[model samples]
Target chain A: DAGITQSPRHKVTETGTPVTLRCHQTENHRYMYWYRQDPGHGLRLIHYSYGVKDTDKGEVSDGYSVSRSKTEDFLLTLESATSSQTSVYFCAISSGVWQAKPNTFGSGTRLTVV
Target chain B: EDQVTQSPEALRLQEGESSSLNCSYTVSGLRGLFWYRQDPGKGPEFLFTLYSAGEEKEKERLKATITKKESFLHITAPKPEDSATYLCAVLASGSRLTFGEGTQLTVNP
Candidate 1:
C-alpha cells in the first residue's frame, strides 16, 4: 500500500454535470498517472504528469482533463459527466523516470455517472 | 500500437493447484514488463517486473518469466487468498504502460 489517497472515495453524479477527482501522494514521486477501469476494457491511461505543471495525454485522454500544479497533488476533471465515464479510477505513482521501478497505486475512486 | 493480451480470461482452481497465466505482448521496444494483482473494487498491487528476455524473478508462491514476445506468471499450489485478477502491463518505447484485460483467477478451498 502506497502513501497515496484519492479524495471522494466514491462519487455519484448526474449526466452533464461537472465532476473532479483528486489524487494526493506523500512519496514525492516524479511520475504520476491516472487510469480508468471499465468492465471489459481493462485499465486505460487517461493522463500522466512527469513533473510539476508538466503533463501529457495518454491512450484514452478524451473527455477528461488533468492538472498537476504541485508535486504532491494531481486533479482530474470531467467537464460534463457521461454515463460512459462511470467506472473505477485509479491513481498511481512511480519513483523512477521511466518506470524502472514498479508503480504504486492508491485504493481507487469509484465514480458513477447516471 | 503496443499491445498486451492475457489468456484464459477466467480460471478456477482448487486449493493447492498450481497453474500459470500467460501474457503475450508486442511492442516496438520493450523497456519493462510488469505484473499486478487486483482484487475486486481495489487498485492493482505490484508483483514483479521482468526486464528482458529469459529473465526470471520469484516471490513466495509466484514466479515470473519473460521471453522476447511473451511472459508467464506461474503460481505454485495457490490458496484461496490468491484469488484475484492478474494484470500484465508493458512499458514500451516511452514510459507509458499498456495493460491487458487481465485473467481472473479464483482459488476455491
Candidate 2:
C-alpha cells in the first residue's frame, strides 16, 4: 500500500452543491492525479499535477477543478455537483515518470449526488 | 485515440485453477503497460509494468507478459484470496493513462 490517504471515504451530496475531495501523500512524489471510476467506463483521468501549482486537465476534466498548493496535498473540487458527477474517485501518486514507475493509489472515495 | 479493452468481463474459477486475463490496447506510441489488482471497496494495487513487446514480469503466482498490441496476466494455481478485479492501463509517452474496464475474477474455494 502507498502512503496516500483520501479523506471522507464515503460522501453523499445533493445536486447543485459544492463538493471537494482531498488527497494527501507522504511519499513526496512529483506527480499526483485524480481519476473517476464508473460502471462500464473503467478509470477516467480527471486532472493531474506535475508539481505544486502545476496542473493539467485530463480527458474527463469537465466541470471539475483541482489545486495543489503543496507537494503533499491535492484537492479536487466540483463547484456545483451534478448527478452525473457521482462516481468513485481515486487519487494516485508516482515518484517517477509514468513510464518509469507504477503509480501508487489511495483507497477510493465513493461519492453520490442525488 | 488511445484505448484499452479487457476480455471476459467476468470469470469464475475453482481454487488451484490456472487461468489468464487478457488486455488488448492501441496507442500511437507505447511507453508502458501496467497491470493492477483491485479488491472490492479498495483502490487498485500495482502488479507489473511492461515496457515493450516480449517483456515479461512475475510475482508470486502471477505473471504478466506483453506483446505489440496486448498483454496477458497469467495466474498459476490461484487461490480464493486471488479473487479480485484485474485492471490494465497504457501510458503513451504522456503522464496520463487510459484504462480498460477490467476483468472481474472470482476464485472459489
Candidate 3:
C-alpha cells in the first residue's frame, strides 16, 4: 500500500456544476499525478504536482485545474463539469528521484456528469 | 511526441494457458517502460519497470521483457485470478507517462 486515498468512490453531478475530487497520500512523496481513464482513450494525464506549489498541465488539461497547497493533498476541480468530463479519476504518488520509480495508485474515483 | 501502441485490444485464454501481449513505443530519450494491472473498478497497480533494453523482470507468473522499440509481457500458466487489464506506459525525456490503450485479458477457468 502506498497509503493513497481518493474521496467519493462514486459521484454523479449535473452538467455545468462544479466538482472537486480529492487525492490524499500518507507517503511523503514529492510527486503526485491525476489521470482519467476512459474506455477508448485509455489513461490520459490531467495534471501533476511536483511540490506543494509546483504544478504543470498535462495533455488533456484544458478544462481541468489542480491545486496542491500541502504535501499530502492534491485537488482536481472541474469548473463546469460536462458530459465529456465524466471519467474514472485516479490518484498516483511517486518518489521523485533521478530515474523515476513506479508510481503507486489509489482506488479510483468514478465521476459521472449527467 | 511519445507514442505507445498495444496490440489485441482484448485477449481471451483458458486457464493454465500462456500468452504474450505486445507494447510498441516511439519516443526519444527513453527513460523507463512500466507495466501495470488494473481490475474492473480499481486503479492501476504497478507491476514492473524496465529501464534499459534487454532488461527483464519477473514476479509470480508474469515476466516482462523490453527491447529498443517494444516490450512484451509473457504470462506462464496464468490463472483465472490473473484476468485483468494490462497497461503499458513509457516515460521519455520528461516526467510524463505516455500510455497505450490497455489489453483486457480474460482467463477463463
Candidate 4:
C-alpha cells in the first residue's frame, strides 16, 4: 500500500545463495529504506537511500547491500543468504528531509533460506 | 545510541476492553516518535506521530501520547478487528529509525 510495492511476496532459497529483493515506489519519495523483521528483534534497518546513487548502511548492515539506481526503485541484496537471514523484509519510503516524517512500508517479502 | 523498548510482548483482550502499550526510548536530540499497526502479513501502517513531549494524537479507538522518556498507545473500547501488532519507532539526530519489539494485540469478540 501507499504506492510502495515489493516483488516476490514469498521466496525460499538455499543457504549461501545470493538473493535480491526489489522495492518500487510510485510516490516519488526521496528516501527509501530496507528493513528485516525477525522474532524478538523487531524491525532492524538494513540500508537506506537518501537519493538515487546515495545509499548508506543501517544498524544491521552486515551481510546486506543495497542500491538505488533510480528514484522509484531500491534493491536489497544478500550476498550469501543464511538461515539466520530468513525473515520478513519490508521496504519503506519517506518523503521528508532526513526522514523525520513517517515512512510508508510495502506489504513485505517473506524470504526463507533453507 | 538511540533505542526503543516496548513492554508486554503480547496482549489479549475481549471486545470493548481498554488497555495501553508502552514504549520507552532513549535518544539524543529526539526528533519524533511514531506508532504503527501491522497485521499478520502486511507492512506496518502508520498510526500517529508525536513531535515533542506532552504531544498527543488520536485516531479512532487509539490515542498516542508522548513524553521525554517514553510513549503510550492507549486503546479504548477495542473490537476484534482491532487486533494486530503495534510497533513503536523513534527518529533522533540521525536518519535511521530505531524500532522496538512490538506488542502483539489480540482482541477477542
C-alpha TM-score for every candidate: 0.96, 0.96, 0.95, 0.96
User: Candidate 4: which stretches are off by over 4 Å?
Assistant: none
Q: Give the per-residue lDDT of model 4 (tens digit) for B50-77.
A: 9999999999999999989999999999
**Scored by Cα lDDT, where does model 1 land?**
0.91
Complex DockQ, candidate 1: 0.64
- Record all residue pairs in model 3 with backbone atoms less than 3 Å apart, i.e. clashing: none
Candidate 3, what DockQ? 0.63
Q: What number of backbone clashes does candidate 3 have, counting pairs of residues 3 or more apart or in separate chains?
A: 0
Docking class of 2: medium
Structure candidate 2, residue pairs in collision: none
lDDT of 2 by residue, A7-70 (tens): 8899999999999999999999999999899999989889889899999998899999999999
Cα displacement (angstroms), candidate 2, residue A21, comes to: 0.5
Candidate 1: residue pairs that collide: none
Off by over 4 Å in 2: A98-102
lDDT of 3 by residue, B1-109 (tens): 8899998899999999999999999999998999999998888999999999999999999999999999999999999999999999999997578889999999999
Cα misplacement distance, residue A9 of candidate 1 (Å): 1.3
Candidate 4 residue pairs in clash (backbone atoms < 3 Å): none
Specify the CAPRI tier of model 4: medium
